[model samples]
Target: MPVTLAIAGLLFATGSNSARTDVDGGRQEELSGLVSQENRKVDAYDQQVERMQREVDRASRARARNDKVAARAQERSDELGRTVGLGPATGTGVRVTLDDAPRTEIGEGNIPPDYLVVHQQDVQAVVNAMWAGGATAVQVMDQRLISTSAVRCVGNTLLLNGRVYSPPFAVTAVGPTDRIAGSLEREPGIRVYKQYVKTYGLGYEVERLTEVTVPGYRGTLDLQFAESGR
Candidate 1:
């Protein structure tokens, strides 16, 4: 009787476990489908916004041509656009590339794995140095940097303006190459990164470009919230 009861309990538990697994799997699939559907809707909305913005810009330009005050405002807006990275900048400058140490070079020494990968600070240090060097504009991996741009790192990947990239990361700046190079050499943060580069076989390369154009930013410029200082 005892043996029969034990067998009955085991069968019941097995059946219940199988049913629970099925239900959980179905829920996972349903959630995944919902996420995909939402993503599609977001893409469609973005396309619509871009089309509407182009129409608005065309109307504004037409008005500027017919009114002197509007024309003055348009000229001022153009000047600000160049300063705020809304217009492409072209000049002779340098491009710096940063990459992780070779995978084969890892685990051969007593160094932590973290030391083998590039960090957010490393990228930010380079950017700050470029700005201090008198860069007119800077581009990271094909995207121009604006006042609000933030460089973030996750594991071995870089997150910039809603996009993700993996090393080797390239930063191009439009400026006097001599001043930029000098600043890069003198930066304390870069000095430490170079030390690790030598010890861990991390990749660092700088190339001078005779002519490089840092494209204007295309991302949305809408501010989510603002406060009145008064």
Candidate 2:
């Protein structure tokens, strides 16, 4: 009877120990599952943070590029203006004027009505002549003439550098007086216009200015598109 009771007690102790070990294993599994879930959440949060940082970095670079472009454009415009005497002045030069010949009669079957007025090409010829004569700077009317500016005429109105003005046009240039005078006399087109000057009494004059000051170029520079490598 004692031996049987001892065997029964040993079996009971073994069963209790086995049950405790199973409980501990279950608790360990639950803890492992929780740790894996937390790790996954942390990984997801880190990915989101990394993506946000990349977007911020790209935006910053784009803004920096735009600012650089703007600065460059401003510098170019400023330099061009200064070259054309559109800025503060310190020089000597010559001033020339050209105007439409006075109307003698409204004739029929001669030259067109538009031909009576000075053409844009006529002013362009004078400006070109000045440039060829080694003009360092030139200004037309109140606008400073630059390398990029175009002088165009539609009907009798003059379009210069995207602006419109009526004649009695005045062109000023900083250069040697003798060279400028020779340029005017030597231009083939000007000679042709001089015929009109005599026939139509068109206004024309070349005056050597002792100290002439021209104005600076005033215009906007907005660059919306550019090649990547340029």
Maximum-lDDT candidate: 1
Deviation from native of the Cα of residue 203 in model 2, angstroms: 1.3
Instruction: Residues 165-221, candidate 2: write the lDDT tens digits.
Output: 567899998888789878989998889888888876778899998888766554323
Candidate 1 to truth, TM: 0.76
Per-model lDDT:
0.78, 0.67
Candidate 2 clashing pairs, residues 3+ apart or interchain: 86-215, 86-216, 87-216
lDDT per residue as tens, model 1, 94-158:
89999999978775667787899888899998999999999999999988998877787766666
- Over 4 Å off, model 1: 1-50, 107-109, 223-230
